[model samples]
Target chain A: MNYSNFKIPAVAVALGASLGGLVYGYVNEAISLALEAATPYVEQGFEVREDNWSGEVEPGKPLLVKHQLFRGNEYWFWAGTSWPGATIKVDIFDSEGNSVGLESFARDSFAGVRALPQKTATYLIRVVAEYSKTGEGLTDEERGANDPVEGVGEFSGSLDWGLVYGYR
Target chain B: MVMIENVIRIFGRAPLAGLGAVFVATLIFGAGLLNAENAPNAPERIDLSNFPGEMVEKVVVPIPAEIFAVLEKLDEPDWNSGIELPEQGDPVGERAILALTFGSLVGEGFIAVQAKNADEIQTIGKRVLALSEALGLAAAVRPHSLSIIEAAGNSDWKKVRDELDATQQTVRTTMEKLRDDELSGLVSLGGWLRGTNVVTSFISNSFSEDKAELLNQPGLIEHFRGLLDSMKGPSANSPQIRSISTGLARLEAIIAPSTEISEEDINQLRDISRTMLEEYYFEKKAAETGTSIN
Candidate 1:
């Protein structure tokens, strides 16, 4: 196996192979570093809906009040009924806790309403529903029962509208 | 004496043979190692004619300014004239919200579609279709609903009220599903992470000042040019470079103007990606071999 004769070529091959590997590793590391350096700031997180329950609404039964929120400039709101057949009235408020306007709708007949503001901002909004045609306050018993509306309903767990400003 | 001489002759010839063998072997080994290191890791510039992902991001990323402008056009109220159907209320303003609803869903849809293991995307898609159908129906029945409100002579604009109520129901249902689905949260996170990619960052930063202006720059073309350069560069074999290039190439084709991304582009990308992988594997093998030898 006289290795002495094959020394030159063996060493050359080994050298070439090693150098190629080293170069490759270095380039990979460089590119990886570049990618790391260029990683953009990804603003991804739970779109925290800002709460603006600042103003007070007229405490009336079936009272329709429009609450303004400086939120959802890029998104819309749809109406949802707790029961299959229900009539719901939603009142929106502003940060000052004042009734801005009122929006009324039927649950089963239609989908929901969306409001697009001139600008983006936060607002204090609430929804209350009643079966009565008169805008009167709900009785304690009625309030205790399965209320289908958001703020004025028996089920208040899902009523809190966390309206986010941006489409996150 | 004869056997000894033959042994000496063989030994004498061994060095030259070894040298030739080493040269050939080294060249082969070096070529293989370089190929392993340099093979394409990314997709090539695709022909846009058959691209399926062109509007993928468009359907996902919300361009607020564009949407707002559209809304304003739809809802611009004429002070002198009375409020007409589309112009009377804020249906146009509503357009902004609509666009986002669809855009965000589309973005999430891509992630859902890509999920390693999850049917959440399908659920979301169903919700989207439902919402879309609901909106279409509402749009058609809106006039009828308004008539119901007006004929009753309800003062508080009951017509408007009823329509809004309907809209609220649909919006609530859609948003609820979006929030409730476990995958929604995950999708958001994934989107955020994807946006953090180097290519994304570069474009975001580049277009920060005026996005519209930036879009006008034909990013796809520029990206293609850069990609071609990267492919020809000395480090073209690097997997990292190849992957980055691949990402860019795919994105460029997706954003390009040829309508659909062509099959050619996808094939090229796949080929490049495969080559890059091969190069990486072989280079790694060579390194392991070298390490073991010394």
Candidate 2:
């Protein structure tokens, strides 16, 4: 048995398999982080509904989901991504394309928006994930000399995003 | 020596194959990178500036509690006046009928909670259990049913409401997991129809603009109609579904065009909802006794 010839190709196959597993693991982590972002609202007496949405989006490209929100109940929609230093945005819109979100905040890797709908109609929620080149919170030395940080920088590609919502 | 030579020849071919594996691996990794960099056909950006309100991947229907919460603000109507329970008897055998009955019962449970009618809530809880058993979801629903009874016993209206919501959600989720999506939609549809009937009846009594606005749910109507349209096999062709579908279309025609529902609109909706319940949903046992659900 000439086992020596199999060494190089076997290593390449193993490497590819590892990369695939890493991508899957990263996406799952993003989903968990997205749910974690809603903990603050949950503490504020918001009942997080079980229904949620998740998908991959290109950096700077926005994803939209439509939901029927009752007029009286207050709602909070939160989104998160696994990409480090990624800027995320979550907002709600009415049928007329008007911004109906009352309060919103976006930080690295996560964002949230609050909405108290004026009518019980199908409203759109827009979520955006963008790559941050300067790695906003990082120090200059951490930014690396020529390239961006490991997960930041010119690697502007699709990012996995998770969205969860709570109502009070 | 011949075996060694043959092994070397195989090794000579291994470099190309090794390169191919690495190339394939790099391609997989690069695809993820390239997709992020330049997502083909991906819209450059989505903003209110050019947002067409299209592309809706999911729609979450507002639970019955959400509307009940609003109705509470408009001056609590006599929720007891709206407490209409179907006759208690053997569980309906058909899954569709049982699903609708379960939904309507949950809706009634909400009203009972609002009315603070402990007895009615308890009865509704038992009926919910019966219907759930008929639908083969007794295990999942029993706990919620028991919770509803306990909450009603203590008069903890909020807990009762939560349990009711949980009950319907559990049924819908369980049905969906069983791939009975049509039944799941029916459960929601059943609850919505019952809720609407109560709301319209209450609004018609008071006839306030604010109260009437609560019935202005064209989106939900469309959603239920879509559910009906998506049904297949016996569930879709059932007389009850067909009747409700027609009734929903009529409701949609009236509600979709109006930003504000007139008193006339309220009466029409109330009548339509009541008729559907009496004819298709609530009157099953009543027909045998020469009585009505109310």
Going through the candidates in the order shown, the clash numbers are 57, 2
Please state the CAPRI-style docking class of candidate 1: incorrect
Candidate with best DockQ: 2
TM-score of candidate 2 versus the correct structure, residues matched by position: 0.71
Q: What C-alpha lDDT, on a 0 to 100 scale, does residue A9 get in candidate 1? A: 34
Q: Write the per-residue lDDT of candidate 1 for residues A1-168, one digit (tens) a residue.
A: 010111123433343222211111121221121112111111221121211111111222222222222221222222222221233333333334443332222233122222333222233233332233222464445455455566543443221111112221
Model 2 Cα displacement at B214 (Å)? 1.7
Error of model 2, residue A36, in angstroms:
4.3
DockQ of each: 0.01, 0.11
Worst 10 residues of 2 chain B by lDDT: B35-44
Q: Mind giving the per-residue lDDT tens digits that candidate 1 earns over B124-161?
A: 43444443454343443333334333423333322222
Q: Give the true-structure RMSD of model 2.
A: 20.9
Residue range B15-114, candidate 2, lDDT tens digits: 6654664466445434423312221122223465675433545556666667776667555578888887866878865687777777888888888888
Model 2 lDDT per residue over A1-168, tens place: 010111123433343223211111122445455566666555565666544576666787667787777665668888877655566777778866677775566667777777767666678788778764654665464345325566544343566677777775
